[model samples]
Target chain A: MNNDILATLSITDATRKLATKEISSLDLVRACRANIERRNATLNAYLEVFDDVEAQAIAADTRRAMGEKQKLLGIPLAVKDNILIEGRRASSASKILEDYIAPYDATAIKKLKDAGAVFLGRTNMDEFAMGGSTENSAYGPTKNPHDESRVPGGSSGGSAAALASGMALGALGSDTGGSVREPASFCGVVGLKPTYGAISRSGLMAMGSSLDQIGPLTRTVADAKLLFEAMRGQDPLDSTSLDPSFYKEGLQRKKIGVPRHLLARGVDADVLKLFEETLKRLQEKGYALVDIELPSAGLALAIYYILMPAEASTNLARFDGVRYGLSRRGESLFDDYACTRGEGFGPEVRRRIMLGTYVLSAGYYDAYYGKATQARRTLSRECAAALKEVDVIMTPTTPSPAFLIGEKSDPLSMYLTDIFTVTANLTGNPALAVPMGEVKRTKINLPASIQLTAAHGGEATLFSIGREIEAV
Target chain B: MYYDAMVSKEEVRALAQLARLRVSDSEIEGLQKDISNILEYVGQVGSIVPNKGETQVLRAQNVMREDILYGPATGLINKGKELLTAFPKREGDYAVVRKIIHKDE
Candidate 1:
C-alpha cells in the first residue's frame, strides 16, 4: 500500500483492509511514522513517539494471524498526555509531572488495549488542560496542520493536530469545557465529548471532576462512534462511571434546535455563514431546524469558569511535591510546597488555582461558587427542557476558525472561544464537533465546525446527525 | 454592564497562599486584574433567582463495594512496587516526609 494513502485512511477503512490482509498493521504504523517523521518536528503534535510502536504493531499482526477479530485491532492512536497508558509518562503537559510515569492504564486505555490498538505516543495538551489553546502546554503548543502559524484548538490540541496531520489515525482526548471538541473544530476532525459518566475516567487526570470526560477525535463520525462504543462502560475505579442504562436514550425526532439569541453576537461572520449552510444542508436532508431558547446558557461560560476552577483547585492540591512528580527543597515544609507549586505549575495553572481558592474561600464562596452552582442547575434544566422539543441543539463549535498562535492574548478573549462548547460540559450532555466547512483567512481556508449537543444518553442521535452533516 | 466586584492584589496574595501557590510581586497585579475580571463575568450567576425551597442538585451517590483484595485475585497485583517507585522521597516501602509534630511544642 502507498504509505501516503495508508496514512490518510480512516479507522473503518483501515480495519476492513486489515481484515482482508490487504495491508499489514506494520504498514499502517510505518506510514504513520513516516508522516510523523516528516511533520512532527514542525507540528509538535506527539510529545514523544513511543519507541515500542513497531513492537505493538507486530503483536497486533500476530493477534490477527491467530484469527482474533477486533474493530480497533492494529489501529495507531494518539492519546492526550493526561490519560495514563501504564508505565508511560502522563505529565498532563505540566512541569510538575514532566517525568511522572503512569503506573496503571486508564480504564479507556485498557479497553483500547484489549481491542488491539497500537499506542503511538502521548500527545501534547494545555498544562492541566486549562487553556483554550495548547499554548499553555509546558512543552510548547501544537500547531494547526492546515496553517503552521495558527494554533490547534486545545487543551486537546495535540491529539487533534496529530489526527489532522495524519500522524495518527485516531486519538483520545479528555474534554473539560471544549478541550476535545474545540480542537476538533479547529482541526477539521470529528471530536466527541460523551455525556458525563458515559465513559469511565479512571486513568485520566482530573481537571474538573464534574465536567471532565475522555472522548475520541477521529476523521469520521463512524470512527468516533466505534471508539466511543469501545470505551464507554462502567468501571469500578471511577465512582461517576455510569452503566448504559443509567440514562435512557432519547427518541429520534429528526429535528435540530438552534439558539439564535446566543449566536446573534460574538460568532464570526464566516463561521455563522458555514453554520447556517450546515443547517440548510441538514434541512434539505429531511430534518427540521427549530429556533430554541436556552436563556440560562448565557451564563454557561461563567458557571464553567467558576465551577471548573473550584474543582481544579481541589483536584490539583494533590501535587504537593511529596509523593511523586517534581520535588523541591526550601527553608521550611511550607516553603517547599509554595516554591514547588509556584515554580512547578505554569502561569495559567497558577492563575486558575488562585481563582479557585478565591471563589471557594470564606465570604466569597456563597457569592461566586454557590451562585454558579445554582445557575448550573438552571442551565441543565433549560438544556433538558430544550431537548424535549428538539433532538439536538446546534451552534458553531468555536466562534471562529483556528486563531493565529498568539492571537488571543487576553485571558477573557481566550475563554470566549469556548462560549458555545462549555454549555455541553456544564450540563453533562453529549456533544460532537463536526467540520461544517472552512472560512478563509489570510489566503488560506481554515476549518470551522458546527457543534451538535444531544440530550443525556443521546449519542446515537448525534452520530446519525453528524454522519449526515459529514456527508453534506 | 460592568460588575463592580474586583479582586484586590492583597486578596490574590492571600488566596494564592491558601492554595499553596506562591505568586511573585510582578505576577500579583496581573492576577488581580484577571481574577477580578473573571469574577465579575462569572458573578452574573448571582442574578439567577433561586427556586422556592429548591435544594442543591447532588448527582453523586454512595458507591460501595465489598472490601476485599480483588487486585491480586484478578492478577492485577505487582503494582505496589510501581506505586512506591513514584515517591519522590522514599525509605523501604514508605514515603518520607518532614515531621509535623514536635514534642517540645
Candidate 2:
C-alpha cells in the first residue's frame, strides 16, 4: 500500500481494509513509522516511539488470523504521555515523573488494548497538563505540522499533531479546560471532550479531577465516535465514572444557540469570519440559529484558573520526594521537600502550585476559591438553563488559529485562547471541536475550528451535528 | 480595568515556602510579578456577587466498594516490587526518610 494513502486512512477505512485482508496491521504500523521517521524529528510529537511497535502489530495480526476482530483491532493510535499504560513511562511531560513508569494501565488504555489497538507511543504535553501550549513541556515543544514556526496548541498538542501529520490514525488526549479541543482546533483534527464522567479517568494523571476527561482526537467524526465508544464506561477504580445510562438523551430541538455578546470583542477578524460562516452553514442545514444569553459565561476562565490550580496543588502534594518520582535531599525535612519540588517541577507547574496555595490559603480562600465556587455553580446553572432551550451551543474554539510558537509569552494572553472552550469543562458538558475551515497565516493556511457544546450526556447530539459540519 | 490584587515579594516567598518550592533571589522578583499578574486575572472571580445561604450541591456521590484484596488474578500484586523500585532510598522493602525526632526530645 502507498505510505501516503495508508498514513491518511481513517480508523474506519483502515479497519475495513484490515477486515477484508487488503492490508495487514504491519502495513499500517510501517506507514505510520515512515511518517514518524520523516516528520517526528522536526515535529517532536512523540516523546518516545515504542521500540516494540512491530512486535505489537504482529500480535494483532496473529489475533486477527485466529478469527478475532474488534473495531480498533490492529489500528495504530497515539497516546498522550499523561495516560498510564502499565510499565511504560507515563510522564505528564513533567521532569518530576520523567523516569517514573506506570504501575498499571489507565482504564481507557485497558479498553483500547481489549479492542486490539496497537500503541504507537506516548506524545509530548505541557508539564502536568498545566499550559495552553505544549511549549511548557519539559522536553522541547511539539511544533505545528502545518507551520513549524507555530505551536501545535497544547497539553494535548502532540496527540493532535501526530494525527494531523499522519503519524497516527487516532490519539487519546486529556481535557481540563480546553486542553484537548484547543489543540484539535489548532491542528485541524476532530477532538472530543466527553461529558465529565463519560469516560473513566483511572490511570490518567490527575490535573483538575473535577474537570479532567480523557477524549479522542481523530481525522473524522465517525472515528472519534468509535474511539469514544470503546473507552466510555463506568469503572470501579474511578468513583466519578458514570454508567452509560447515567444521562438520558435529550429531545432534539434542532436549534443552535450563539452567545453573540461574548464574541463581540477580543476575537481575531478572520477567525470570527470563519465562525460566522460556520453558523450560517449550520443555519442553512435547517438548524435554527438563536441568540442566547449565558450571563455568567465571562467568568468561566477566571473560575477555571482558580479552581484548576487549587485542585492541581492538592493533587500534586503526593509528590513530596518520599513516595515516587524525583527526590533531592537537603539539610532538614522541609528543605528536602522544598529542594525536591523546586528542582522537580517546571516553572509553569511551580507557578500554578504557588497560585493554588495562595488561593486555598486561610484568608484568601473565601475571596478567591470560595467565590469561584459560587460563580461556578451560577455558571453551570446558566449553561443548564440555556441548554434547555437549544440542542447545542456554538463558538469558535480559539480566538485565532495556530499562533507563532512563542507568540503568547505572557501567561494571561495564553489563557485567553481557552476563553470559549472552558465553559463546557466547567459545566461537565460534552464538547466537540470540528475543523470549520482554514485561515491564511503569513506563509501558510492554518486551520480554524468551531466548537459545539451539548448538554450533559448529549454526546450523541454533538457527534451528529459535528458530522454535519464536517461534511460541510 | 485594573484590580487591587497585587502579590508582594514577601507573599510570594511565603507561598513558595508553603508550597514546598525553593525560589532563588533572582527568580523572586519575576515570580512576584507573574503571581501578581495571574492573581489579578483570576481575581475577577471575586467580582461575582456571592449567593449566600443556598447550599451548592456537587455532582459527586460517595462510592463504596467491598474492601478486599483486589487485583488481576494474574499476579499483578507483584507489581508492588516495581513500586518499591521507584523509592529514592530503600532499605530492604522500606522507603527511607530522614529522622524527624531526636532522642533528646
Candidate 3:
C-alpha cells in the first residue's frame, strides 16, 4: 500500500488489514514516518519521532508471526509528551524537564504497549498542559494542519495535529480542562475524555489530579473506542483508577440534552448553525433533543479555572529543583529552587502556579478555592441530574473553530475556547468531540465540532451517539 | 468592570515567592494584571448557591497503599540509576543538595 493510504487508514481499518496479514506493522510505521517527514517540520506536531520505531514495528511483526492476535498490534500512535513511556524523554513541553527521561511507563502507555501498539513519538503540548493553545509550548507552537496560520487548539494540540496530518493512525492526549477535546475539535478528529477514574493515571505527569484523564484521539468514533478499550480500567498504581463496575451503566434513552440557554451567546454564529444542523440530523434519525437548563453551566469555565489552578499549584510542587528534572544551584537552598523553577518553567506555568498559590493561600482559600469546590459539586450534581433524564448532554466542543495562530493574545479570550468543554472535567463525566462539519472562515473551510457528554461510565453511550454524529 | 479582589505587583511577587518560583521584575506587572483579571472572573464562583458543607465531597482521599512490590508503578522500583540521571546534580548514589544548617560565624 502507498504510504498515504497506510498513514491515513483509521485504527479500525488498519487493524483489519494487519489481522489478515495484508499489511505489515513495518509498512504502517514507515507510512506514518513518511507523512511525518513530509509535514512535521511545518506542523511542529511531533517534538521527537522515536528513532527505534522501525525496531518496535519489527518486534510487533515477529509477535504476530508467533500467533499473537492483539487488536492494536503493530499500530503506530502519537502520544502526548505528558504521557510517560519509559526511557523516552517525557517533557510536558517544559524546559525544566528538558533532560528528564521517564523511569516508568505511564499505566496508559503500558497498556498500549501490552496491546502491541507502536509509539510514533512524543507530541508537543503547552508547558505543563497549562494553555488552551499549543502556542504556550516552551519549544514552540504546533500549527493546525488544516490552516498552518492557525492553532490546533491546545495542550494536546500536537497529538491532535499529528493524527490529523496523518502522522499516526491515532494519538493519546490528556485532558485536564478540554485540552484533548478542544484540540480534537480544532484538528477535525474525534477526542474522548473518558470518565474520571475510568483509566488509570499512574506515570502520566500530574496536572490537575482531579481533572486530568489520558484519552484517545482518533479519526473515527470506532477508532477512538478501539484505543480507549485497550487503555481503560483499573491499575493499582493509580488509586483513582476504577473497576469496570464502579459506575452502573444505564439504558440509553436515545435522548440528548442541549443546554441552549448557555449557548445563546459566546458561540460563533456559524458554529451554532452547524451544531443545530447536527441536532436536526440526529432528530431525523429518531433521537430526541431536549432543551435542558443547567444554570451552573454558565459558571463551568470560571469554576474550572479556579479549581484546576488550585490543584495544579499543589501538583507542581514536586518540581522544585529537587530529586528529578532540571536543577540550579544558588547561594542558599531557597534560591536554588527559585532559580531552577524560574528558569525551567515557562510563563503560563508560572502564571498557573501563582494563581494556585493565591487561591490556596491561608487568606484567600475560603473565598476562592473553597467557593470553587462548592460550585464544582453543584455543577457535578446538575450534570448527573441532567444525564439521568437524557443519555448525553450536547454542546459545541469549542465556542468557534480554530483561530489564527496569534489571534487570542489576551489570556481571558484564549480561555473562552474551552468554555463548552470544561464542564465534563469538573463533573467527572465522559465527553467526546466529533467533527460535525466545517464552517468557512477567511475564505477557507475550518472544522467545527460537537461535544457529547455522557454520565460517568457512560462512555458506551457516548460512543454510540458519537458514531451517530459521525454518520451525520 | 470592577475587580473586587485585585493582585497588586507586590502580591504577585509574594505569590511567586510562595510558589517557589523566581519571577523577573518585568514579569510581575504582567502577572499582576493577568492574575487579577482571572481572580476577578473566577470569583464569580462565590455567587454559586453554597452546597452547605458539600465541598468536602471533592476533598482528596488517601490513595497510599502498603509498601510492597506490586503494580505497574513498580516499574520504577529498580531503575534508580535512570531516575538519578535526571537529577541535575548527583554524587554517585545520591542527589546533591544545598545545606541549610548554619553555624555561628
Which candidate ranks first by lDDT, i.e. highest? 2
**Residue A120, candidate 1: how far off, in angstroms?**
0.4
Q: What DockQ values do the models have?
A: 0.60, 0.58, 0.63
Candidate 1 per-residue lDDT, tens place, A97-124, comes to 9889888888899899888899999999
The interface RMSD values of the models, given in order, are: 2.7, 3.0, 2.5
lDDT of model 2, residue A143: 95
DockQ of 1: 0.60
Q: Across residues A206-305, which tens digit of lDDT does each residue of candidate 3 receive?
A: 9999999999999999999899989999888878889988655544689989999988888899999999999999999999989999989899989889
lDDT of each: 0.91, 0.91, 0.90
Indicate whether candidate 1 or candidate 2 has the larger lDDT: 2
Docking band of candidate 3: medium
Candidate 2 lDDT over residue span A1-472, tens digit each: 8999998899999999999999999999999999999999999999999999999999999999999988899999999999999888988998888899888789899999999999999999999898878999999999999999999998899999999999999999999999999999999999999999999988889999999999999999999999999999988788888889876564388999999989999999999999998888878989899999998899999999999999999999999988799899999999999999999999999999999999899988878887788888889989999989999999999999998988988888888999998999989999999999999988689999999999999988998999999888
DockQ of predicted model 3: 0.63
* Clashing pairs for predicted structure model 1, backbone only: none
Model 3, residue A255: C-alpha shift (Å): 1.0
Per model, kept true contacts as a fraction are: 0.72, 0.69, 0.76
- Give me the runs in candidate 3 sitting further than 4 Å from their true place: A247-251, B1-3, B52-67, B71-73
